[model samples]
Target: MGQHLTIVDHPLVKHKLTLMRKVDTSTASFRQLLREISLLLAYEVTRDLELTSVTIQTPLQPMEAPILEGKKLALVSILRAGNGLLDGILELIPAARVGFVGMYRDPETLQPVEYYSKLPNLLEERMTIVVDPMLATGNSSVAAIDLVKKKGAKNIIFLCLLAAPEGVARMKEAHPDVPIVTAALDECLNDHGYIVPGLGDAGDRIFGTK
Candidate 1:
């Protein structure tokens, strides 16, 4: 079975994504656009979060209200570019536990190697949402997911701002159970392995680095 990849077509998300895609958008504007898009993505990603009813006293009388059920969520960010998405999601899920998995590509092997990994306690009990701005080859995202799974995260969702078809297919093959949500699925990756017509190097654009 293929992994579920949802391209959030919400109006606001589409607008911000366009701004981010423009070559002329300034670094400040690019960073702000990313934050806005992430928040919109987070909203769609968490739409199905479990909620339970509770009885509480209101200003006038007692009434039943619904509150989040199950364990608090865990937001695992694939470092560097992923950190850009992490900030906005955190603003909405303020109580969510934060985790980081840092990986760097080996120039020789062209493989992802973990430099750091840390997650919250009781990961198995929490609904973990992993964020990475771009899913190109899917190697880094897959490795990050494996790390979290080893830490006992059964319920996982992969969130990205943009994705390539190859990357999405790779992830589905590796982990069919994980759902992938993204802003857009672009054309094939170019010869340099960057998503075609994709926002140039998300990390570089957002941070104003080379």
Candidate 2:
């Protein structure tokens, strides 16, 4: 994964992830855990955001306060599963501009097929964070990032709850510049393109579907 991938090894994050992995975990619990974990991941993902100072008056006196520079960042959810992580991160960064890119994998080829995309304007002016719960084959993520970049997004980051080695390699080959943040980098992907030891189908678990 090199420097492009960062694993959030916080104990709280891992504990919640464990609960989420259990097959018996309820939908409400899974949803809540995902939201909490995303907030922790969000903290790490935005660790390097550029900050500028602003003068502010406190009870003590006037002081220089650090504030994020430039326009609010954009959060692009790779829908269905992405929305799970999105709901959580949104709580941490409610001021961020929201967008969505809807895509699905072809069961046979395991390739991404885009059906919808509604991104925020002025991508060139804001940092874009692409969110998805799982990164398995990574085809969807690569395709989504390609769209974001073409729309003039210069600064980009890929955030997910779990990442597979195959997916990490795919992203590195396609977008070496963009960094990836995840709760864990699991073992290799299964033959069907699902991450092993993964929390089953994140979309299904989150939405309480079969």
Candidate 3:
């Protein structure tokens, strides 16, 4: 919880990521790889979830069983592409509550503009994990996090597939307390705010849109 940033460097994660980066990777393959990689990333992010023991009965025996403690987790996706990561994480943590936040960039100012938001109630109590595939300029990410915080989400973690140095720095300055978990921390952002060496537009690659 205290770590500011975590770059998941597992071999499997790296392998799938390499495949995802290929321009020739078809939409179906890209989507499948995203789901596979997301499962691995979700494992790393949720590795430290608090657990408590509860008494349970097993065929002619009684014993204590470990179960997740405290309020159930809430998975909030930063719209469009975030849904790709959300679907895989949901497979791993099926019982988690889900929400969505939609935001688009302002072409003139290179800023984020929120268009939609729907969050769970009593967010202050539940641990919230926000998902997005690419953290480029981080304007939208920061805006999305701000919205969740306004709704009372105190404990929050951001999960993304790739991040630019600019985005990471921006997130650190804005929300130093929130931890960021990503697969790769790429080079600086390009002139148009795209992550250099990034797998192009995540939403486009994910949905086969240009």
Candidate 4:
């Protein structure tokens, strides 16, 4: 994949994804596995972050230490299910700023509608990463990024556990400038807009909701 898309194929990531996809995986187990997988995905999502050096004295001698360039990252979770991934990523990057975007699908129209939004200020100065567990239809993900970009977020990345081809294509067409990092790109979306051979409704699975 080019800079526009990155599928994290680490052996451990694939193993955890398989476990999460199982129908019998317990709610607790599924949640835990998502947390574990998020940590792995975080590595790939942030692989290309810019770095700057700082002069520092080690215990023995002076050295120029490499430090992450720019402001602390801004992590925007596409609410509910996104929180599952956000929690694990926060443990790895404790200093990152957090934000939220809530979108609900309108049953009649089958389109995403924003109901809540809270984002960090100065988004233009930081790298923003949008998190959502499933990229099945790509409606909410695209809408969420639209809001983020409107608030001056130019450098952004989309992170998710699983992606469907239809969703990937939709995002590529809408936000080609944003890079997408996902654990696995599944076969395709079913008629009902769920991924085939993929984990079921991520929000329900993560929250143990209907």
Candidate 5:
């Protein structure tokens, strides 16, 4: 809804996402699809990263080319499902530092409770990207952002494979300064709070659980 949310509609992204959404897709295929889609999403998400000129020798001659500048990136994975997307983004930016945030919902309250969290040094100085496979209710996502903010990260980017409108709205309301990037925005959340017509439980699908 806000200008910060970038829903990537690239054809290749759409194609890969469709495959990942199929009911019959295997764990192997699902993992591969997540990796591929993550790469595509990372490409779009990092478009505005600062660049600096560097001297290099080209095949034809010596030249000064622009390369990524400023503080190194810090990727914060929202545990399990987020790890799938994290792998591919790390492949692209190997120099980027890695962090993890794990939260599990309480069975009765259905509220997110943190289990684990760790971050890189100078977090406030680096561009931080948080990856989560699905943004269903947005509670976990918001809580994750809260944790990161506590660590003093100002420039934060949230990346997910799929999102629901409710989750998006919730995120914007909670953290207007953070931008979200996702492959698809689905219809609505079902009674159980799962994204309807959504690829069933992303964590389960990625790990081949029921």
Candidate 6:
């Protein structure tokens, strides 16, 4: 973990991200594309998962097979937008434990305010992945990770659809042990804290809200 960031640059991820960035893309289409892209990014996030061999019965004979090591993963979605990534990743890793952290940005200060948090027990023993669609200002992400850490989560990974340089730097400064995975790292954050050239207001787009 050490302030790492992985940009998933696969063709499929790039293509879908392009469509998702379009303002003309329908809400339904945006949601679907997010699901699709999440599936692909899931590959990168879980790429380094440890595997151990165990004795197993094959079609013809007994053999050793590789299986995931250690306890099941814990996936903590950072509220509404994170759900889009969580759903798709869960489909890939059905045995994962699920949690949710709800936080809202303070209008005046542009800070994070935690509203709800319910996480699984034994967080320290599991690999936790925190999902949020946009890492624009990173205030929410940093706050959300802080809450997760307080629950004893040790191995943590932050997953998102898009990110800004400011957000990435902020995350590095706050939590260097948590790695970040995203489809694209955008240029910078705007005055309103939106990622430039990003799929605007991921929560609004995903939920069809203003």
For candidate 3, the 10 contiguous residues with the lowest summed lDDT are: 104-113
Clashes of each: 0, 0, 0, 0, 0, 0
Error of 4 at 51 (Å): 1.0
Residues 29-54, candidate 4: write the lDDT tens digits: 99999889999999888888899999
Which pairs of residues have clashing backbones in candidate 3? none
Give the alpha carbon lDDT tens digit for every residue of 97-117 in model 2: 999999999999999999999
Report the error of model 6 at residue 112, Å.
0.5
Residue 75 in model 4: shift from native, Å?
A: 0.4
Q: Which predicted model would earn the best lDDT? A: 2
Query: Tens digits of per-residue lDDT for model 1 on 52-76?
Result: 9999999999999999999999999
**Each model's lDDT:** 0.92, 0.94, 0.93, 0.92, 0.92, 0.93
Question: Candidate 1 — which residues are off by over 4 angstroms?
Answer: 1-3
For model 5, which pairs clash?
none
- How close to the true structure is residue 55 of candidate 2, measured as C-alpha lDDT? 100
Residue pairs with colliding backbones in model 1 are none
Which sections of candidate 5 miss by over 4 Å? none
* Candidate 2 clash figure, as a count: 0
With a 3 Å backbone cut-off (N, CA, C), the pairs that clash in candidate 2 are none
* Candidate 3 C-alpha RMSD relative to the actual structure: 0.9
TM-score of 1: 0.96
lDDT of 6 by residue, 1-210 (tens): 343899988999999999999999999999999999999988889988889999999889999999999999999999988999999999899999999999999878889999999998899999999999999899999999999999999999999999999999999999999999999999998888889988889999999999
Off by over 4 Å in 6: 1-3
Q: Model 3 scores what on Cα lDDT?
A: 0.93
Q: Which residue pairs show collisions in model 4?
A: none
lDDT of 5 at 68: 88
RMSD of 4: 1.2
